[model samples]
Target chain A: MADAYESLTDHEDDARWAYGTGFSDPLAGVDTTVPSGIDHEDLAAYCLMLGDDALIMSHRLQQWVTRAPETEDELAIANIALDLLGQARLLLSRAAFVSGSGDEDSLAYLRPASQFRNVNLAARADADFAHLVARLLMFSSWRLALFDRLTGAADPVLSAIAAKGVKELTYHRDYAAQWVLRLGDGTEISRGRMRAAVGDLLGGSLVDELFAVHEVEERLAGVAVSPGGVKEEVLSVWGQVMRAATLAEGVGTTAPAGGRPPPGPPPPPPGGGGHDCAGGAFARAGSAFPRAGWA
Target chain B: MTSAAASTAATVAAGVADPEMPMLTLGDLGILRGVDEEPGRVIVTITPTYSGCPAMQTIRDDLTVALRAAGYREVEVRTVLTPAWTTDWITADGHDKLAAAGISPPGPAPRRAAGPVPLTLVPRASAISCPRCGSPETETITPFSATACRSLHRCTVCLEPFEHVKEI
Candidate 1:
């Protein structure tokens, strides 16, 4: 450890994982040159959209730490959080590389809430273990499907990142699915809690936010997979898991129609279910996990 | 000026132990891809074990430091992502070292299939032997542990908890 004076002169130590700064450039050594036909701006934006989702969701999951019911389960959730954090770092670094702008740190910490591209669900607080698993199930299902398709994206870097992510996301989805089943099909009280969690988290136009295609996705045709493209696949897995858990497929309410973001940039209006609303500020404010409260 | 310099640099770089698992060298772990020497500079290409493996920076720093100590003034450690790393890359000696250290080495990695990953409620049962007792009666306590590439398990025979290098 460096003293205050030494710390000022030697910033290298600041980058250590514990210090939160000096992560080796996640994309270092990997060729980041934008392919001939792809637009750098569009590629950057697309990366953020996915990166923010992972970053925000990872932060949310980290809140579970010691709060998890079991020691092993706590480790599992923390592992999942780390996996998503790694993915977020890669994607954000990719974005910074192509955009000719700030680096991963700047993009993550400097951006305003309105500028954050994650779906709202990623940032929402979970009520309990059931809600956490329910959200994880939905989030991982969509992301896993999207990442599986992204393995073949036109951009080499994106393709590589997605291919690696597929393996990690598989474990994440499996963990969530297992928990959902355990709670939803167990004793009546457990079943009721699981069902209520699904209804509260997955019900109401919230999920539609995941499928709504944004302009950045529209612009980056081959380079990006539209969220809408993976909708059916994500929904299928969700339905399968829900039914097997003995929970209602829809859990009661369907996503309200007519809330889809209007195409073109400037991002969806704030009211847009998932992608809009709380930005980085909302996430930052919530990051101070009250340990006492959890205990 | 000679190819021998590149091989020497490679030797030095490869000899550096993984910060997390000192029992294994980067070469044994299959992360040290290659070493190219030119004039006064050496370039080392390596791959990460996992996407979020926090040890990447330390590995990079260690490689640079090792190469520099071996008389190279300029060293560059490059990370490659394609041909994503798998436990299968761990060398024979690496596995032996892990077992000797009481950490069960990984089995064959699960082969990935095309299309969306099929969701399963139960972990696929794998044949893991006790590193301490060599009993094939080990069960997974959880699929995750202190790091992304390892899982927690307990040997029913010896009743000892151990970390297994996960099959990616």
Candidate 2:
């Protein structure tokens, strides 16, 4: 072993895994040209929708660092958050390229809550461990289903991003599913909490909007994978996981009270009534985890 | 430039070592896709081992600096995400280097079986052998590790902790 280790010590000082230390452009060689005929605005909006989802979801996951039930779980959640952050960077960069807007940082930190196009599920305040698991299960399942089809997108960058995401999201869904199963079947209190969290999320329409196809999505037809196209598949997978977890399948089946946003309306700017739909701000304040940079 | 000059440029770029796993070169890890010399400029294309790999920037800079020091006028490093990088891409030499460094190399990429969703489970202990003791008595310490591409493991025989390159 000593001899073998000695042979492998050729370049020991290089810290290859450090983040952003010697940073360079991730999209260095890739062509960012907007394909002919596709509306740049539509493409930009679509990328923002996806990017915001990942960014907000990453923030929510970051809340779990150092607070997870186990040390391993803490690392796992952080890893998942980092994965989403990577996806957000790529997608946001793509959005910036298409829209000719400011870069990813401008879109992520500069924009306010109301301007975000992510589904309300991701932006919700941190909840109990059960609620977090339930939300992750729903979000990862849906996103994975969507990404599976997106690997074939007409846009090469989108296709590449999706291809990378499909693998990460697969692990995310499975991780969440295992936790849901354990909690749902573990103890009386744990089971009840898991069930209630699932009900509140599904009943609240936090995930329904994800299935509602946007006009920008429709306009990009061939280039964008339709959310509606994957809804049935996502639902079916969710149903399976619920059954496996012994949780109720159709706890909340009501249509969301609001109608879908009309097509061609300029995307909503950051700031509005929809920002605090579920008392998310209050929950954030009440949580044990320190909320510093996130707010 | 002649074909011989281009080959030399490729060879120089391939020698740039991975920042994290210093034992392996970008070429050994199968990340160095190509190095082309055009007049006074050199373009190096590489694919990341994992989507969130932080070493990419360092690798890019290393390539630029190494080539510039070797008489190249301009060096451009490019990252390509398509044909997603996999552990299977790691060259045979990379496997030896990882093993020599007391880290277990990866097995085959996980098979994508026919299903609505692929099952992601913890890395199986049976598939990996201890790099330190060369013992098969190994167990997964955690599915998460210091980097996205690796997982923590313990060798029951050697009683030492090590990281295994995760199969994507």
Candidate 3:
């Protein structure tokens, strides 16, 4: 073993060591070729939004690090978070490179809440593991649709990121879906919890999805993910998944969220934990991705 | 053998399995970070397939051995864990290697999870030219591939669903 060390010690200017540093041509890369349409600035903003989602979600997932019910679950949550973090790092780094911002650290640590444009879905942490799965299933499917469209982004970098994310999202959705089915249909307690989780997690934050902040969407409309391209389809996918799981559990496909008409019109029922009891209310909007500090 | 080779020298590449997809090799995914050869030891540097990937240690072990077989005998592998890895690391050639293995090549999407890594429930055409047919007309069959680094895709013309190596 010492021989290996000594041998390596003699080899200065180690290319291998250099490779790990991620040094490379920022503009010219395998995924750098821009498609016919795409505004560089829009691409930058789009990347920032995506990076923020990953970074924030990863942060939430990290909270579950040692608090999981089982060892496997602990590792599973952590792993999932790590996956998101990895994506956030790359996306943010790419965003910084394009925007002339610093890097991932600056964006992740320095930015405040409102600056982050990620959907509330990612920003809101679940009250329980099952809630997490319910939220994850919906979020994953949406992302899959987005990534699928992004694969063809006008910008090579965006396209490349989407291409890879398509695969990861698929699994992320599937894993969450599986859990959704399992928990959603498992037992009375499990089902009740699943219902609560779904209700708690299913607040619509479509405004973020409907509008495109960066010009990238317009520039890469045909090539990169276009607004509204996969939204409906992905929603269908989630619905189908939820139905399938519900059917498997021998339960009605859709029931009033938690067996009651969600809080609408009228106000909370005097401190009964009603209305304000996490039925319709969701997270406050904020900035999850800021300019990165250092790469 | 030279003292460089014999003086407790060990070369090992972190053989970390890509976290998203555990089956493929880091080389296949193009995320084996770096293979460092130091005197008396070899240090393998690797970034997770996803920043939050569950199995970075395995990659480190694999990298360690890769170097050991090549030349060095002793090994010390470390996870760079910073700057992270991305689909950009998946080389054009590496994509082919993955495809040839029937493992699907990654593209367009950086195979590794990136910041706020966007997910896809729907897919549009990306520049993922089919590795088998070199046709850009490909569709994503499954957003998730058999493994994390790969997304299941089918060449429209070929009518075959193949694995695409994610750029991560």
Alpha-carbon local distance difference test for all models? 0.80, 0.76, 0.57
Candidate 3 C-alpha lDDT tens digits along A1-295:
5766675555433333423323222222233333444565666677887877777676666666566666546655665676687678668877777777676677766765556656556666556677678767867777777776677555666665666566556667766777787777677667766766665554443334433334445554565455465656766666766675573342323453445433222222222323333222223443232122111
In candidate 1 the C-alpha lDDT for residue A149 amounts to 87
Better candidate number, 1 or 3, judged by TM-score = 1
- After aligning candidate 1 to the native by TM-score, how far in Å is the CA of A255 from where it should be? 19
Instruction: Give the number of the best model, judged by TM-score.
Output: 1
DockQ of each two-chain model: 0.61, 0.37, 0.11
Q: Kindly give the stretch of ten consecutive residues in candidate 2 chain B with the minimal lDDT sum.
A: B116-125
- Which portions of model 3 show Cα errors greater than 4 Å? A1-37, A203-216, A247-283, A287-295, B1-168
Off by over 4 Å in 2: A1-23, A249-295, B113-115, B120-126, B156-159
| lDDT tens digits by residue: candidate 2, A1-295 | 4687554453543433353334445677887877788888888888888887888788778877767888878888888898998899899999988999788888877875456677776766544677788889889998998888888888889999998998888878888888888887677777766766676676654566778777788789888888888888888877777877777554444221222222121112123324433345423332322111111
lDDT tens digits, residues B1-168, model 3? 334443233222323444345554566556655654556766555555653343454444445555656666676655443343566666675555566665555446434454433434234456676667777897755544443444566789877767765554
> Which tens-of-lDDT digit does each residue in B1-168 have in candidate 1?
348877888889889999888999998898887788977799899988878888888888878777777789999888888878888999999999999999999988787576667788777775889899999988989888877888999999889999999888
Q: Candidate 2 residues B31-148, lDDT tens each? A: 9877888988998999977666767778887888789878898998888898888889999999999999988999998778665666543233366888988888888877777777
TM-score of 2: 0.83
Off by over 4 Å in 1: A1-21, A249-295
